[model samples]
Target: MTSQSGLTRRLSDADEIVPDSEYVSESELRHGSDQVVRETSRSLHDNDTDAIMQMFTEKEFETSDLLEICGPFLLSDTAYNVMYMSPGIINMIPDTSGAASLPVTSLFHPDDRPILTETLSAQTHDGSIMARLKLKDCSYAWSNITIRQGNKNIHRALYISNTDELYRSYITQKKSIATLEQKAADLTRQLEAVNKELEAFSYSVSHDMRAPIRIINGYAHILETDYCADMGEECRRLFDIILTNTGQMNQMIEAVLGLSRISQKELFITDTDMPALVKAVTDEQLSAVDNSDKINIETGNIISTRCDSVLIKCVWKHLISNALKFTAQEATPHITIGSERKGDKVVYYIKDNGIGFDMQYAEKLFGIFQRLHKRTAYPGQGAGLATVKRIVMKHGGNIWAEAGTGMGATFYFSLPVTDQ
Candidate 1:
């Protein structure tokens, strides 16, 4: 048989194992009465105790020492009856004095009994299992258990490691995710309700508000045509002013309704030929205006983008119309449409050699009914840029303008590039 000092040296090496010669007979293995047997048992138990104590005291250990150090561990038979337990286990568990020879399930919470039973049942002597176990205070802790088979498949050593903090964090994160999901569902319901109210309001504005405006416009037309011959020049001029103001009011109301409709419209995104769309809008606008010959339009290489074609067409129309209207006084109106790639998006811009506004008011440029130029000079209700901004926003894009007084203006808009 191997000597006690030799066995102790082998255990100290941690990586080396004591040979079978070191083990005593079955009777001595159980009772450990022989001097050599007693010393070997004491060495094994002390080695584990020292490693575990070092772990708790110094908070560090080598990997080879880890199996012995990670404790609150147990030694059991194949039937999961507790044969022996580490000192740490006795200290960690309350009322465990008579725990020896009892089923391992006694140490677990009632809810966790099945977990230990299943792990013990499925595990071979060579394999191990992990589970969360309850403590004396009723709090749960995560543990990793490792098992080592002994001679005759009779005895096993189980190494346990605490992992309570990690499990607790995982549970907290799961609850947080559940809470966020509930909040998202609540927000979705609120959004749907708001959309319904907006739809109703839009319907009322389209029908109820426009009816009176149309009637006023019709009466003004009748007064100009049917009563013009009977009225003096000053009265005719007054009638003219009434008709003009009514027309402006009608445009403003239409612009507001258009903005509302665009917001409600569902986007049908597709690969749109931006150059062709711009050309079409400019052509249509040119056809409607009398000063089309005075305007010179230039277009650069424009890449195709995924967007709502109808809404984008509206955007281009408003921009082109604004350019033409602002530059109408110029001897030669110059307008350029072009685009370039910027990171994940394509930025398209319209440059106009026309009368431009101060950059200080740029923040208010896209606001509804906000005007930098007088209505008498510009001949618009200042809703064109606002409508363009809304359309751009609907397409997951943005629009802005750069300008200086009397120099020129460039309007830039960006659209994300997506596969067709």
Candidate 2:
């Protein structure tokens, strides 16, 4: 039972062991010991030192030869107390004084000490464990730790290999993922605050501004009916102008209110007969205007779709009235309403041969208060398309338009088909 340190001291003088002997050179000794050393280490793991000692004796090698070939490792008792530290281990450590007698757990990071203790206590021979070790400079490095039963029943061997660079990359990636998740949460809160502010603004505009406009229109109407005869021609003309301007203002207020309400409205979806709905809206629009006779309306066999009937009706009313108003100058106006299946959705379109607009401003058409034509040419507050867009979006659908000046216009909307 030679102590590991005594054996290590003798191995330093190994060149003198087989010197000037019969035909055996130093290279031959080393080559023959390579295979024998590998077998000894394997047998050491299996606690079979009898075979290892027999092989060494048969090869005419001493215990110092075995110590020289065993390579770098640490020997510890079952209690994890360090018994021996190889010369390689001493060279790698920046501070090697008193390292051999220290607890083997002192080599690992404080947080990793418990994990190493549990793994060794389990005496698991199935596989190796891994942990971060404390380097001599107080920095940390990752290493794979293998525990094998030693030749002595009370002793064990620990084999450690550096794996620091790969573990550091893994830690960096995990930190980046955590940072990205925090940023995403912050953005979501900002978006929620902005939405709340918008709702409050819409409510204020709808309620606070309508009262004064209503009062002005009411006064103008009273003067027109009660004081018409008492006024001169000039006064009468001025009164008529005031009344007409007030009427336009009232239309503007109604349009703003409609746009605001669409944002707060809830949708109730059902199978709606679109052809009948379109016919009813068109008939109502035609009856209101005296030029219904000049307008030729054509409707296709539209498929029934699942949608909010009230909201969809509003969409049809705005589109139909827009066609009628723009085509007032034409001696004969043509308006077509139809629907077709496209992929998983039904695309419905309203096409009109009316005073169309340039396609370049198409993107702005659905914005609030956005209009291509002047108020004089088309009497509107420019909120019709904006309202239509909101309603379409609330139903998880989309709206778009195509037009060229005097070439008529077509407005298309898509709704997903419901599963049967």
Candidate 3:
């Protein structure tokens, strides 16, 4: 049981005494009783007086005793039995400590000491010491303290509590939050870097790749037209193959150039006839190949919705050409262009009975220079599909493919009729 300081009355024997108003308690009367008079009589009751005087005179207890003058009084070792005062008297007398006198200054919280002392001296039973104490090994502690009173010989005690564990836990949680935030920032930076690289690579595909392709294509055109008389037929065929390769290179370069251009174009948005546009692009692509007699067009009425005609026409051109190229061996290649209305948006599908792709390599298909088929088998620079993807994305549309190895391919694209 923790003891607190308090005050109470004590009964005593009547005496031939100075009939003053009141006398000290039995505990306090240990110094002198009313019957035991002393008038500079040093030799009289020398032992008991010295003991009581020693308690007051000792330098160790002096300042502590001064503080206890306004503290609560309690029995030495019990929290149950206590003594104190009324509100008015308590208001008059300011209390300073919560427990009995045993050096509490060492236990004082560094930040609380000054405020505690000044506020304690200012008011009685008002304010409390609620502070974190500095402990060993740089830890913290918490305590709630209040003032109490003892006998005329005032003494005080201080209460303490430790909070090192809770403080450590709080610090750990804050560090976790900071670590997560830092990781998020790192990921954001990494994403920005990846986007920049993609943009730079797209620019290279447009500018760097086309310069050499133009030289080869222009020279090949001159050779096939003007130098046909000088070369053997077999040699001419080889030159024609070279011309074909250069033309394919030109196609790939244009695809990437158009992709890069879509990013910079002013979004001149207006309602467009999607069905008519698809038909027109399909006819133009097939006429270039001169293979429509071999490849069959599926339907006259597919779907017409709002879109950028030039951009959408480019999209149709690439999709249709890819279908024609891959299905060249088919005796009757079938290509169907259609659109499905999903909720408020329209999704376009170009279904082709062609040499389709495997689903496993779906993620890599849109990457520039990533080719699923060998050059001997497919004969492309591998950028046409990537261009189609970029253009759709720039228009706030999503494009995807569904195909299985040896099965036909189906391309789907979704777009909102409204522009942002």
Best by TM-score: 1
Prediction-by-prediction clash tally: 0, 0, 19
Model 3, CA-based lDDT: 0.62
Better of 1 and 3 by TM-score: 1
> In model 2, what lDDT does residue 266 have?
77
Total clashes in model 1, counting residue pairs 3 or more apart in sequence or in different chains: 0
Return the candidate ranking by lDDT, descending: 1, 2, 3
Model 3 regions more than 4 Å off: 1-256
Candidate 1 residue-wise lDDT at 262: 84
lDDT-better candidate, 2 vs 3: 2
Q: Write the candidate numbers in order of decreasing TM-score.
A: 1, 2, 3
Against the reference, the lDDT scores of all candidates come to: 0.76, 0.75, 0.62
Q: Once superposed on the true structure, which residue ranges of model 2 sit more than 4 Å away at CA?
A: 1-195, 215-240
Per-candidate TM-score against the hidden true structure: 0.63, 0.55, 0.44
User: Over the stretch 154-218, how does candidate 2's per-residue lDDT look in tens digits?
Assistant: 88887665433434564576678888888888888997787677677766666666677768878
- Candidate 2 clashing pairs, residues 3+ apart or interchain: none
How do the residues 149-185 of candidate 3 rate in per-residue lDDT, one tens digit apiece?
3334243333231232344665677689899999999
